[model samples]
Target chain A: MATKKKVTRKNTTTNKAKAKTKTPEETSPAMDNPYISASFWKAMWIICSISVLLEFFIHRHKHFEDLESSVLGNISNWFGFYGMFGLIACSGSILLAKGLSVFLKANEDYYDDTP
Target chain B: MRIITMTLLNNIPPAFLLIIGAFVLLILPARARKVGAIALAFFGVYAVSQLVEGSNVTPEFLGFDLTLLRVDSTSKSFGYIFTLSAFGALIFSWSERCRLQNTAALVYVGSALGVVFAGDMISWYLFWELMAISSTFLILARNNKRSRLAAQRYILVHLGGGLVLLTGILLTIHETGSIDFTKENIYQNTVAKNFILIGILINAAAVPFSSWLPDAYPESTIFGGVILSAYTTKTAVYTLVRGFPGEEILIPIGCIMAVYGIIYALLENDIRRILAYSIINQVGFMICGIGIGTKLAIAGVVASTFCSIIYTSLLWMAAGAVMYRTNKSKCTELGGLYKTMPITMVLVMIGALAVSGAPLTSGFISKTLITAAAEHQNYLWAWLALKVASAGIMLHTGIKFPFFVFFNVDRGLRSKEAPRAMIAGMSLMAFLCIYLGLNPGQLYSIIPNSDILVEQVSFYAIYIKHFDHVATKFQMLLFSGLSFFLFLPMLKRTRTISIDFDWFYRKGAKLLYSGIDKTFNSINRAAEHIVIKTFLPSLVKFIINAPASLTIMLFRPIWEESLSADKTNIKKREQKIISQFSSGTFPVAYSAIFILIFIAILIFLGRSLS
Candidate 1:
């Protein structure tokens, strides 16, 4: 997604002056206000760390205790399985959505207006 | 039978109060209308709250007993939420001057309550159609070209569903000679049952027919969209629970809808359209629960339905406030709205977390019931799919909605806060979302059937003790959030929509209509050629020549006799004939003269009329 930055003359002049002082890469729009900033990712890392560690101490019970537990089930029983599964599922779903969009995406005006 | 004193007053169904309230609001002076509507909401809630199960009021309609008001725990559970939603929506739309939108919204909500309370199939059908028609006006009330078109499509799809449902009801009645709204021995293979299921699925926004929800909902007026998000699908869920619990097929259908909604929402750019898709995804969870058919599962369906109605409506209301203030709906066109509209953003976040099943939120408690039920039933595949879908929900709705609309790169747009009325309405629902989540006993107590209630209570009591289950859910959601940032590039908003089965009807129907038109045109063209090249000219020639030819033939014999009598007589007759027939081809000339005169006269008459 391209972020729309309104470039007024005053703002442009300030940016140009700043460009004279700062490196071009630092002045790039993408670097200036990234959608997910370094600060946000830092917070995310901390949250993930806490949650990943917390998974170890939690005691969970299964609804179907009598079901034949297998290797996959045993693996899921390990700590952080849900976290790992979620990461994989989320990534997979995003990729799947992107893949589906290749076939299903169309011009927003696919339905005409004249009726 | 117990004797009742308030036969006329108390027996009046809450549905009628709302219907009557709509008319009363319409008639009251403009200054008094809002007050009148608020009063009606109060009365309606009170009326519904007072209703007792099994104390049905049956009215005779065409020699059949019509259950106009069948109060039960199931009906009351739905009634409580429906009336509550109406109250919130009424306050949300308090500033609306359009009487039609107001009245229609009331009728729409009232009819949903009626469907919830209806004890007979015929009355259900009547209230069902009333819902379809009245809700349509909410879309049409926008009165713009897009809304007009969307409203038309919306009604057509609903009417189509309504017809299918009416067909099912009629068939069931033919087979069983009863119209009571109770469990019937409808087999999976039966045509009537399938018809009924498909009809309800259409309203539920289940797969194949699901596109209508996204197609039409985003186009409604703000309050209209808010009210619309509440009743239609939830009523269908209520009906499904009443009509077909444990059907088994709904499990797969629901699972598909759950994932399908996520994929579509992932690709959507419009904020409200994303919310609309989430409605489908959330309902899918409920439907899956209903399919499990265990007491816990059914309770989950009812509880989730209740929670979904509030949280989804809140999401829409918050999004609507943004659109109202900024006049932009597409995510690509919105960002940093939180700067000016902080309250709206906070409310939306609350709705978002609630929908994502965050701990101590309505969705967490309600969704667990279904997932746990799937586990108890040993439906491993369903349990896994639902868990993944749970993660998917957090991705698409819980984060995507607020991230794009409020927290993304600044679009440099500023706006005033949402109006107080809208804020009040959202706050009420936001409070309820947390209240219901933190204390689910209030919600569980309302689920129909005593047996189900007991099971639900035990399930609730036990589920909280499972630290692992709660921990896993949090891990999934937190990791899902992590995945979202990792794949942020792939999830960029785009100004495109994913085409679904509606393509068949929206485009295919256009193709079919034009094909019919082309066929008619070709037939018309062939007829035009025959008429113009052959029949028309021949008829014209005949008409012109016939009169002149007939006159000439009739006078010829008399003229010949006069010519033979004397040269002097012949000379005068020949002079007269020469003067009249100066052209060499006299009959052809006469035909032309007649044709010109006939055409001139027709033109003269045509001109005179104008």
Candidate 2:
């Protein structure tokens, strides 16, 4: 009985030390609260869905009628044209930046060693 | 006394009043300087408001009729915003005790006002250089090695830019025999116009010369960033509208700037550098508008400048607040700050949304006007590019900034809310962003060419005048936000900085230094070797041996014949004589004979000449 008690005490102390030394990511309340994260993602999706749905109900005046008719056709008048364009532009910019980063990105101290 | 005071108020430009106030700040207690700055800024606004629509002060300068203060719709609008931004920046920095920065801030503001109001090229150039010099102290006030280096580079670039501007002005003056800073005088000489355009574009942070903005601004003292954001580029835009309206080149340049800013901001890790790039992006929109140069486009540019100054400063202030509380600036180092600094997070969101041109914000109203102008002008590519940039703004500043700073995965950082003064300053700008956005008519009324904007307002009856514009912008920005989350993994912040045009100066400067060292210094080394090592020693040896050698040559023939049987004895004697001459112990008669010989040679030459 005495040996078992000692083992339990040692285990508790080690567990406490582990908790104490946890990384910020592990200790963060937001990280532990899965419900909040889930709800936030849900809210984001709902908001985005409504925005896309509103595109169908709302009629957008085409700024480039000639170009649209000649090349893009009615694609610009589609329900999610603005949304898709936004998506493509944003994603394209990020991807392009990522590609460029291979050449352009440098260590944070890049300018520090320089005169 | 009353009459003198009234005359002084009427004759002295409001800009000069703020400058005088800056000197006054020097004498006041450290605590009082802040209040003094705010009061002076308010007084400047009132003085600007009271001015009539002509040159307010004309001073004779070196036989030139200098217009010290000129008031027009454009200058008036710029003047009001400059003073107002000064007031806001002063309030934000109230807690700061650095008297030099406080004084420099006031002077900086004063000189920016001076640039807008100056009616001649000379005074404009003077104020422009003063603006550059005074604003540099704001960066140096950080008093760190990095900030020091950044300030040095900032001043050098501005001085170079000022020289270019002065060259342009001098050329324009010579060509026209007038110093008036009018479009007619400027555009009369093509070279002068191009020089002036390049000068202003450098300040405007247009592509290649733009790296200075991001390089220096983020390194500034926290409050300095807020003040720095408001004036320099906006003043350049003001000048562009005043001088280079309808220049077609700015259209392409502005497009490239917009796209460049978006790409860089996407790659930047520092929160403040991202804001700095967005300044370029926002200025690009205005530059594009100025290029359009229609009455509607000009009005849009002016209105957008006013709105951009407020919103961009707001964003800087919020970032500064975060930096102040946590002493961390990189987005990768910060996360879940909303838990501790909710007020700052909210203010930043407002600023971020406004910058993104979200619905019912000041950006929405101002940014749409530019696009509307582009569409009206049938520049389909510019319109499409601008729309893409608008969504780009949403991606970089709107979502990326706030997300990485406040809402990303928790980093377990904690800090109290920003100082009350910061909050108050931010709230003031935030209120204006929303206020001007909700009621853009207030801003439109103050903008240059207001009549055209009003006409367009009625024409677009579908824009802010209706809900369709709102819906369209909403659909675009929200979808952009959706894209942000979908690609969150790709947008991960790393502890890295993206190379910019400054790479030429930052890295290329060292390359240049080494190149010069190798070329010039090596030549210098060769010259030293020839003169000191080879030439000097040989010349000394020849001079020392001259008299002895002459004696030896003269006597060697006689000795060789006389001592033909005793050649060894003659050789020993000759060596002894040469040693005596080198040791300065030779007979005086030989030196006398040599001097005589030199005199005889001179006499012979003189005889020949005769």
Stretches of candidate 1 exceeding 4 Å from the true structure: A1-33, A69-75, B1-10, B185-189, B449-464, B515-610
Q: Write the per-residue lDDT of candidate 2 for residues B1-610, one digit (tens) a residue.
A: 9667665766778878988889988999876777888889888888877777888577898889889888889999999999998888888887898888878988898899889999998999999999999999999999999999999999999999999998999999989999999888899999999999999999999988999999999999998999999999999998998899999899888888898999999999999999999999888888988888888889889888998999999999999999999899998788889899999889988998899998768888788888888888877778777888899999999988988888776777878999999999999999998988777778888888888766544324535456667886788898788888777778888889999999998899899999998999999999999999999999999998987888888888888888884878888979988989878785788779778999999999999999
Q: In candidate 1, what fraction of native interface contacts survive?
A: 0.74
Name the top lDDT candidate.
2
- Candidate 1 residue lDDT tens string, B1-610: 2236345545888888899889878987775888788678777877777776675688899889998888878888899889888888788777778878779888999999899999888999999999999999999999999999999989999999999998888888888888877767334228988898899999999998898999888989998999999999999999999999998999998899899989999999999989988888988888888889888898888888888898898999889889888899987787777788999999988998999998778888789889988988887778878887888999999999999888766676678999999899899889998988777677877875446555335435635665566677888899999999999888887788778777878888888899999999999999999989889999987875665456556656787786665757755655555555444345577679768989999999999998
User: Which candidate comes out best when scored by TM-score?
Assistant: 2
Worst 10 residues of 1 chain B by lDDT: B1-10
Candidate 1's residue-wise lDDT over A24-88, tens digit each?
22433233232454567899989888888886676666445666565555666667878898899
Question: What C-alpha lDDT do the candidate models reach, one value each?
Answer: 0.83, 0.86
Per-residue lDDT, model 1, residue B284, is: 86
